[model samples]
Target chain A: MTAEKLQVAFTDILKAHQRISPYIHKTPVFKNSKINDLVHRELYFKAENLQKTGSFKARGALNAVLQLKEKQTNLKGVVTHSSGNHGQATAWAARTTGLQCSIVVPSYSPAVKMEAIKEYGAELVECGPLPTDRNAACEKIAAEKKYEMIPPFDHYHVIAGQGTIAVEFLEAVPNLDAILVPISGGGMIAGIAVAAKHIKPNIKVYAVEPEGKILEKSLRAEEMLWPNPPQYLNTIADGIRLQQTGHLTWPFLLQLVEKEVFTVNNEEIIKAMKFVFQRMKLVIEAASGAAVAAAMSDQLQKLDKKIQHIGVILCGGNVDIDKLPWF
Target chain B: MTAEKLQVAFTDILKAHQRISPYIHKTPVFKNSKINDLVHRELYFKAENLQKTGSFKARGALNAVLQLKEKQTNLKGVVTHSSGNHGQATAWAARTTGLQCSIVVPSYSPAVKMEAIKEYGAELVECGPLPTDRNAACEKIAAEKKYEMIPPFDHYHVIAGQGTIAVEFLEAVPNLDAILVPISGGGMIAGIAVAAKHIKPNIKVYAVEPEGKILEKSLRAEEMLWPNPPQYLNTIADGIRLQQTGHLTWPFLLQLVEKEVFTVNNEEIIKAMKFVFQRMKLVIEAASGAAVAAAMSDQLQKLDKKIQHIGVILCGGNVDIDKLPWF
Candidate 1:
């Protein structure tokens, strides 16, 4: 995707924001005095963790389903693969439209997530560990059943939906110096960067990633960072353990995002989670923790201090209590 | 307190809301479809747990301090007694005014809470567990130091301030059938009952308490029920283990409240916490859990079937993560 194409993506996202205004929550932005004092930056948290399905995934998922209105008459249903928040969002979106949907999940996924997905009346297809295998299984099922494959972060509609966060944030606080987002499949940050850059070209966009998995590296290198298998992959922030970015979202992010900063280990993530709970009194998942961790890091401290206003995307709040890393 | 007096209390609360509008948050209201289905009531949760200082006590404390217009000229400082939310609120209130303040905390108070109180730059005075003793100590210190005592719930200004929740809730969701609130010192519920009843005379006010606590007995017996020694008691809902209701608040509550309900044991509280965590995806402490537990009971479910809009006050969010009794 070219810079011009990314600009067009911002236009699409802004339009989606207007279109989905009725259905979606215009989730609030919260300022933390303690966080600002500690980070030495004026932080405005875009609280998408408080979004309808406990994640910004809802925006993207809803955007995808709504965009299918042109194809709604001939649509059989929706199909996707997700380990967590995306699956729930897809399920919720399907139920909202009264569409039959099937979500393929890895067998090792948390029971609570599976329950949430099933509770939304979406059919669950459990598969083995490999991410590629799960996608392949979802693709096979989609082909057979003629269900629309709503790729979690790759689809243009999904990017457009997630991009609305930037639109809302910019509208709420227009002088943002930078926005930090947790990147997994790249859909969220990709959309956000495009919208933010279009509105304010100087607003630096930073994607936060976990230490081991680096979609940030892949986006910068402009090639797949391959052979980086999930080696002892364990983090409390389960939302962003993706091995690869989506083909559609990757190029878009590469063109727009300024840099990708990886947070410290799981210990830091858990510590950040506890910090959020104690200071802000908000329940955010590990993915949100990763963003906070990045923002508070020494690496970002100087840039954060230089900025007049900074925004951090609190991406989700769907934390499983039983498996809470702190517990 | 007469119905007319309660109406006056609400009028004061409205004024307090105006005074504190820029400082306080009109926290969001959320509904859980699954929990609502289980309880068979359209449960509207006013999320004051997300309020500043993680409790509704902020309202009363701030209001009390703000009402010190005459004393402002001679204001040496403020004094309050609490090992929990009230202490934090007082500390926060004092900080807002950039005034010196002292908090009398029981010896058994959690370090986390004490740390928070200190973080607000309030002077910490640890006293014996008994409220009478603490009050006496606070009085002695106040007399010696010329500091004004800010009684947590007993004061008129505090109750009026706390009553702001009911004022906001009624305005946000008018025609609510009932309000379920967790009772401790009774300031929160007393204020709420007074305001809610004034607005909607038929509005049922239910106060939820820990089973072993005295609020339930006091409300039922139509008299004061004091703890054996009137000392701090051990309970999961540390924030609500008040030995006695405020004399000022009890009369207000006795006149306006419809009923007081009790939730048995820490297990029930934990179960309620789990319900909020999993179904509602909101963080509620044990105090809030008591209200939820009462609202979910079989007895409450048998109430007016037409009672579609029942609002539950999640009054606080401050829970010691270390002592979170998930086990």
Candidate 2:
């Protein structure tokens, strides 16, 4: 991969799928006619919220660790820093291979997410709520414990791993006109855009962000944006509050994503979450809510033309019910 | 269909499947390793929660209405009384065929449920909390409006409709040792038992109820028991809190179900709901929780020789998130 390009091929996603099929679930494509009527589009929801570890992170996390083991013989363990699903997923992936995993979590991360990381038998390290602090903690752990650091979104294998979701999704509903993906550190959408665009050459890949639309700014500037991470934390979509896109992922975003980057606020995301929870009977995290909220937004009709069929990825379902956003 | 017996033939369920395939979803069968480890058996969860109107009732309600249209000349409308999922389902089924539907509900039913009935364009009739009041309201509406009464669980068509779930469940995983069904009006279990027993004759069918163990009591007495419905209202599983099994359903219960009818308290049901909501990432109502609770119970391990593969029907997912049981 060059500085201005994403070299992660469709074959890599296919390989990732082949390697992780036993470990991950080919989550069902779900639809609610009520939402379809409101949006005036036939929307197919790729339900990765029902995936193992309750997110699509399991595929990427497992693929990265499994591929790492395939390449290196003396890998003692793996270390990574994430606030939510990725931390838990990496821990689960490590446990599967009998490898020790140390997950550094932001102190602001929900207790339910932390508890899951601990339940997977990972060494839980809590740090201050900043991307820099998380990175420092992971670096320190990797240096001292001789553990290979698995950066959440900035790696090739991780992008390829997440790309597998697109393969399964397109195969399920081949006629989808586009796919709406929720963006955090850009890995999930980056991977999705790569595979989805490859499969359906004319398919539009729309990136949805919370109130803080850093990706949009980055795309307009033709460079990755790095805003204050705390500024992005106001939204209830806790999983995708990271400030910057990855070096490797930003290029994919630049090339593959639709020009119009969609944005929804905390209220919109919560509304989408509630709709799915109450009507559709699916528990979706705030990040997934971004995609759902965007799907239901009037902006879809305001597009260059009406999209007849669309696919929305439900990224995760690890929200704290006791502390529901609406309540 | 005699008063003393259930004759919901396997062919009835098969025909029901063919009739309602376009209207209802073939809900996915979900399994979690963590749940499997806790239960010490492989449990396939039939996710009817994701069905239309967010319950398995859609299958039966649709089958009844569709079959009614076929058999009758001019069907004015369909009417039924239900406190929750069934009412919403019947309203949705009627709307599908552009048939006028009047749903009678007890005053205590959640506003979300009542709103759903209205949203589906059904005439919402609110009655007193007594089951008798609900029945009287339905009878009054059915007579005055010339609407055919589609009872929730007692009728042959409804039984056959609910049985379609068993066909889908067994077809997905044919080698199941037994199916754990959450019982309310008993039509669902009766249809399931007939279809499942016909498919796999030795397959055990276990009935799980909330705090009120009326099914166990009725089975012991060799007759359908009639207790006051209000006496059994002190449980979180509102969907299945009805007092007695249907006349037709009771005979199937006596002949097909295992001798032991397992019962769980409200606490067990809530715990199970939380597990599914948090870990499995599915929004399951308390009726589904009864089957889930039974799966995780200690009594499952104590059963005569370990029954390895069990299909647990997740009856519905129409709980009010704002008023979750744990909260």
Candidate 3:
């Protein structure tokens, strides 16, 4: 895809903010003196963990659903395939917009997550525990029911919706020198980078991912490197375990994101999660931990000297209590 | 003790708020639609867990230390006996004002709690596990060092300081029909009751405590009832395990507080803690959970119909991760 075709304009993000203002929460920016002392840089946390549906996915989902509503005069429903924050977000967004929604999840997906999707009043369809199977099921449903399929991270409206976070974050802490966001299919960071750079051209945007993810390698290769999911996915951060960046998101990320994608180990992610819980008094999921870990990692040493203020997006807090790593 | 002698004027609370304004956080009042639906009342949570030093104890401690600094010219230090939030709060308050502070904690106190006190630069004195032993140690230190005694809940300044919470809460949600607070030595509730009642004369102030604790019984007897700690105190809420109400605080409770105190079982407290963690995205200690549990309990059935808006004080979030009851 050419840069011109895939480009997400600053105006799109601003429009997304205006469109989703009533539906999504403008999550608070939290700061801690102790954390600042430890990092040697002032840190502002955009607490999307406290967002509606407990993730930044709510922003994109709501925007997409709302946009769909405006575009289609007779909206039948929306369909997505996932067993994560996105599924819950889509379900909640559909419910909020008074639309029928269906989520296709793997049969092996955690019961708690599936229950959450159902609780949000989404129709749950169990498919085989594979990406291909899940995708095929979603496709079949969309074709059969004429439901608007909302892609998790690759679509224009979704990316635009996700970009709204940066507008809110920059507004809250206008002087932020840098922002760290966790990358899954690159939708959130892609959106954030586009918005942040547009708002303040000199501001830096870094994408953080769990170790063993191939996003960094693909960025370096200048080509999409699809890792075999079962073999390569070893990180505990379930949210960001994508094999490859979306076709639409990859181009935007290549142009917008910082050159080097930061990666943190599971141990570092767990430690960061614990730190936020203990010191910051917030319960954040492991995916959110990756961003925090990257901010505090040795890779940011050079940036620390230059940047006085850093913003990290705590993307979610929907961890299953029984499965906490500490236990 | 006569009510006249221990009376805490609303002006004193206002003065405490002014003195501690810079030293403490005016914690945000959080509301959840799900929680509102569950309780059948609009519940506003005063998130003191997010407060400086991780509890409302900071307010009282800072007020007392600041008061002592203003009153005495040769202020050597301040001493208090606590194994929980108060110890850390006192140490933090002293450090903030550049004064020496000593905390007398039981030998059996958790190492994590002790480390927190020392981290605030306070002198740690290890005493026996009994209340008498801790008090004696504090007395000895105060007598030897000429340090003013900052009682956890009994003193006028401490009560006035804690009363500041109500002032802030009422300001945030002015039309609250009732306010719920966890009672330890009756200091927090006493302060809140006085401030809340003084501001909104007809507002109801209810004290919540762990089941089997004698605070409810004491309020019923119209006198002080000190229970045997080892025999009667079996609740997981260690923060509010005090055997008796403070002499100064008791009078305020009798006059300003509502006729009946609410109590919840340990099981209910754990359930509330988990609920807040999962739904509210907050990690609150069991003491905080007591207030939440009381608000959601069957005991609030009659009050639920009458009270449209209720405020529950989330007292603290300083829990040992390894010792979390759920795990």
Candidate 4:
């Protein structure tokens, strides 16, 4: 897909915001003077970690489900394959909107996450841990039950729904010079970058990833790159461990995101998570820590000194205390 | 002091709110339907854990300091003896208002807390952990340096300051049938009870305390009771291990607070803490968990069925991660 053809407009985000307004929280923006002093730049944290379902995934899920409800008069339900925040979000959105939803999770998925999905009243389908197995299970469920499948990050509606976060952030901090977002399947960054740049053309959007992810290599090559998952996946930031970016999201990234992708290692991510927990009194997951780590890294020191106001998305706070890295 | 003579008026709380408005945050009130279902009551949580200095102590400390600044022209400084939230709040209030402050902490105070006090630019005075030693050190500092002492609780201004929390709570959740507060020196509860009753004369105000504390005994006797701390203090809630309530605060508690004081064991407090951490995604200390435990306990089942909306004060979030009870 061409960049112009695949790009999400600001209008789509506005519509998504309006449609999902009742079901979602306009999450708070927080600032800490101590963090500002440590990073040598003013930081505005868009705290989607405190969002409904404990992540920004709620916005996209709600938007997709609502859109489905509007288009289909005889909608059976929705099916999605995810074992993380997206799964919980889809289940929550479905329950809130009075729809039957099925979540396909790998057999080895964390019991806590599976329990949360069950608590949200979603049917649970178990498959092998491999992505192909999960996808096959989801396809089978959709084919058998005639359930509409909500893609996690690649669909235009999902990207547009996620883009609503940038709309809120920009409204809260109108003069932010840049925004740093952790990239997984590229849905969040793709949406945020397109919306932010549309609103403020000169504002920079930087993608942050775990050190082992292929996003940086893909961004540099201006093409999709999927390294073997076993060889390259060793980071503790489980949320952004996807092997490659989505096709629909890649064009938005190419058109809207900055050229260089910021990367942080597992140790730095853990340190940042601990710092945010202790100093900021927030229980942010490691995936959110990746963006924070990049913001505090020396790599940002080379940016224009005049780029003083930086915004970071605290993506989620759905961590299992027993599995904490520090523990 | 007689109850009438020591009473804190609602006007005093209104004044304190105005005086400290510029300093402290009007902390957010949060509600989770899942938690509400588990507790069998609609719960509205006043998030003082997100307040300045990560506790509602900021309200009392700022109010007391501001009152001093208003009354005294040549205020040399202020002195307080505390090893917990009160000390940090006093330090933060003093630094924010450009006043010299000294905190007399026990030598056994946590290093993380001591470091925070120093970071707030307050003079640190180390003393023995015994109450007598801490009081003596505070008195010496007050006498030699002419520093006016800001008692942690039990002062008229301090109670008035803490009372401001009730005002905000009532404003946010106007028809709350009951409010549960963790009792330490009785300042926070005393203030809240006075303000809540003044605002809605029939609102039930419950005091929560750790098991074995003398608060329940003292409330039942309708007078001050100073049981030996070493004999009765065996709870994990270190923040509320006070031997007795203050002279000024006791009168307010007797006259304004509800008759029965709710007590929770250390085990129950830890369970509540873990539940809040997992469900609410909040990092609350043990003291805050006391109120949550009381709300979730069967004790509240005896309350009038008309009492539907319950408000709980999440008093603080200053737990030492390294020493977490679960960890």
Candidate 5:
């Protein structure tokens, strides 16, 4: 994609912030006195874990559905595939805007997540594990039924909505030294980096990933591809354990992100989750835990003591109670 | 205690609020859309679960410390016996105000909680499980060292400090119809009930308890005693599973509380914790969960839906990661 395309994406992000402000939570920002002592720098957490639908997915989903214009007026329905948070977001978005939603999912998706989707009144389309199969089925269903296929990450309006985090963060704490965001399909970080870097040219943007699912490999290699083969996915940071980034998200990330860091194993994520819970008293999901773990550990060696103030977005808090590791 | 004595206690509560405001968090009140639907009433959670040191204990501890007058100026240290939240609160309170703290903990206290006490620079004293034993040891230590003993509850200053919750809640949500509090040593509820009923006579005060532990029975029986003594504390709601209520607390509660209710079994607490974590996206301890469980199960059968707007203090969020049912 060209630089002009990326700029349009950034512009759409600004517009999305304006459009979705009424529906979304501005959510609270907190500084951890306990974690601050350990990190030796002021750490601010944007609590999207407390966001409606328990994740920032609400921002993108609402933005995407609302941005559909006259050309897409004949949209028969909204369809997307997600294991949990995104499906719930789509269902909520559809319900709020008076539309039918059909969320395609793998047959093996967690029962707890399925229950949430059903609770939100989303029609389910269970399919195989392969992303190719799921995408093909969703596309075919959209073509046959005249449904508007809502790509979870690889869409302009979705990125724009996710970008609103940057706007809010800048408004909340204007002179942030750096921001560490968890990376999955690159939707959240891609949007945040674009808006934050655009608004404050000197501010640094960092992407944190689970050890096994390293998207940083692709970003640092200057290639638009996953580091390992397509089949590698083993991490407890389930939300960000993606095999690849979206077509719409890669160029924005490559252009905007200052650095991308990988955290330790699931053990580190668990440790960080426990540390934040015990010290900060904030419940954060594993993806959010990865960002905190990266910041707390030696991954950001050079920037550790120097960054005067840092911001981390707690991306979501939709863990299955039964599946929670502690029990 | 006489009604006039209770009136004087209310006056002390007012004084405590002024004393603790500078130190404690006037935590935000939050509402969950789904929880509202379940209860069939508008529920506002007074997020004391998010307070400094992750519980409303901070208010009481800070109050007790600050209430130390000129005569107590020779106090070499402050002593308290607690297994968890109260100990952490005292440790934090002592550190914040530059006072030495000696926390006499039961030998079985979680290492995590013990670490928090040590982190705050409190001297840790390990004792037997029973409060009588721990209290006696603390008393002896206080006598030997000329240190002031800060009782968890029953102490006028402690109750007055906890009363700050009711003051803040009523101030923030002026039209609250009722306030439900989890009863342990009775300090939290006694303090809140006195403040709430004193300010607004019509506002109902309900105290929730785990069925296995019958402190409520003792309250109804008009006695300061332990009831249905645990074979060993089994409920996951460790924070509220106190062996007994305070002597000073029971008298205040007898006059102030409108009703007392109890919930049984680990399943209910676990289920409530799950609901709060999933629906509210808030990290609450089992005591808070017990209150939410009480709200959901119509534990207060006598109360009507006419109590439209209610406030529940999510009293604390200090659970051991290893001990959390959902992990």
Candidate 6:
């Protein structure tokens, strides 16, 4: 008899949805008349900002940890290196699932995120700001403690976990002509594109990368390539400024996401963030703002497709309120 | 054989709910585990921050406008005196009901509010910064233009409209031991106390007033009295700083709401606002924050009645983002 392997199949997303629903929120979908008017389209915002741990990271993290619980026995707790939403998400998931957690955060990571991870009862470790430093620190902890390493996005189970968002978003607004997604390590958009296209093949997937063309530049190569040294720190959208796409996530992004991924600058991201706060009255992080910046821009209107009803995943809302970028 | 008179009865709220359901959003009820752990009690927040015009004022305003539309024929327009949420709400209500609207805003009103009122296609008239100035200007406009005056609160229909919130809140969380409401002109709490107590006789109604204890002081008098000048501008919670309770709403406050209203200072209000932004990831106005402040305080835990399950009405989220009070 063949065993089910770890993969991001459509059925796996369904299973992930069932497994993670209890642990995370089915966050609300919001619509604003003024925002719709500004964009001249029927924009349905999937408010994952209100998700558990205040981001969609909750979905992937919980899905991964819960599956691990079912497969393994007496596993040394989970370990991950993330300085943002995913860090808190892993901690929350581990704590909820009755397991210990350790998060390796970059030295320059925001204090708020580190505090949140600690509040979830996870051991917090600080490392250098570089990607290699984060991974080395995370791997050392995993090796020394026999803790299972859960990469932020590359793992197939993590991608499957994030695919659940597409299921929920599509369920809420079934006729969404296309979905506008934010691109980080490509976990969310990859899962979203795969799941969304499977459900409705004609539904296009457009993506936005915050202040960097790494995704755009790398995809042009014959084979996928990661950024050198993998230390990206360019934009105000600190959350989505990953230097490269995940190895597993790259295929889905290259094959499914629209060719023209929107690249937005810090100012554009901030403008979109302000629009949501002033108009929709929802607090969204700059990573989500990049997606919104794409949604709010003029290019969507001039697209070739008759994209009337668009879905924008407001991916997170864990912003530092005291240090608003606008000021 | 007689027609239904304009009165804020329990049935009126039921009717208002039915009538206004199409126009307003049935906003979600949100709960944060972190917040619950901090307060040591489960708190259900009715997110009227996501309501139309970004406030629960939508419920009352829409009901009043729709009722007016049904009662009168060929009305010149509807006019109201409000410098904040109520102003934008009235404009949205009027526009939604296909009625001509004129808003008499105080000169000191925020520019964002004035812009919103105008954007809703309401004729904006600015008056001096005083209660008398606003009312006189509204009355003058109504008399000259034959526009019907829709008072911000104090009207029977308006109170009935406000009561609809209680119906929704109770429906969502039926077992709530008590409800925490933000008091402004008493329209909301009056409607809520009547409707909620009628729905569940055992339910307790507690109210919160932002700094400046007019409600507390007035309840001591022989008759329900308006503020000496009826103009109050204290505390950063500008949305709910009404100097006095409404005539119709005051009786409900005295009779149904617990005698001791929680009076949160500006500091407490701002603190609550910051907590919500940091944790729940919602941009709540200071007015809504006042209600949350009361919910977060230790007094609830020390109360005589066991408020294990508390319902808080986040009255609005029409805050000026650029001018956040905490900053």
Top candidate on TM-score is 4
Q: Pick the candidate with the highest DockQ.
A: 6
Q: Kindly report, for each predicted structure in the order presented, the TM-score of its chain A compared with the true chain A.
A: 0.93, 0.95, 0.96, 0.97, 0.93, 0.95
Q: Model 5: residues >4 Å from true position, as ranges? A: A1-5, A8-11, A69-76, A212-217, A225-232, B7-15, B69-74, B212-235, B300-302
Worst lDDT run of 10 residues, candidate 2 chain A, spans A224-233
Per-model DockQ: 0.53, 0.82, 0.75, 0.62, 0.53, 0.85
Per-residue C-alpha lDDT of model 5 across residues A124-206, encoded as one tens digit per residue: 89999887878888898888877787777888788888999989988899879899998878889888988888888888898
**Candidate order, lDDT descending:** 3, 4, 2, 6, 1, 5
lDDT of 5 at B195: 89
Model 4: runs farther than 4 Å from truth?
A1-3, A228-232, B1-3, B228-232
Off by over 4 Å in 1: A1-4, A214-222, A228-234, A260-262, B1-8, B214-221, B225-234, B260-264
- Over A114-227, each residue of candidate 4 has an lDDT whose tens digit, in order, gives 999999999999999678888899999999999999998998889989999999999999999999999888899988987999899999999998886757777778877775
Model 5, CA-based lDDT? 0.81
Q: What share of the true interface contacts does candidate 2 keep?
A: 0.90
What is the lDDT for B166 in model 6?
84
lDDT of 4 by residue, B1-327 (tens): 444665578899999999999888888888888888886789999888888888999999999999999989788799999878999999999998889999999998889999988989999999996888888999999999998899999798999999999999999999999999998888999999889998899899999988777577777887666754423267788788765777778888888788788899988899888877777777788899999999889888888889999999999998887778987
lDDT of 1 by residue, A27-111 (tens): 8888888888887788898888778888899999988887895666878689999868999999998888778899999998878
Residue B141 miss distance in model 2 (angstroms): 3.0
lDDT of 1: 0.82
Report, in order, each candidate's fnat: 0.33, 0.90, 0.64, 0.33, 0.67, 0.90
The global C-alpha lDDT for each of the candidates, from Candidate 1 onward, is 0.82, 0.87, 0.88, 0.88, 0.81, 0.85
lDDT accuracy of residue A96 in candidate 6: 93
Greater-DockQ candidate between 1 and 3: 3
lDDT of 4 at A125: 95
Off by over 4 Å in 6: A1-7, A220-222, B1-7, B220-222, B225-227
Model 2 lDDT tens row, A170-229: 999999888999988788888888899899998999989887655677787777657545
Error of 1 at A283 (Å): 1.6
Number of clashes in every candidate structure? 0, 0, 0, 0, 1, 0
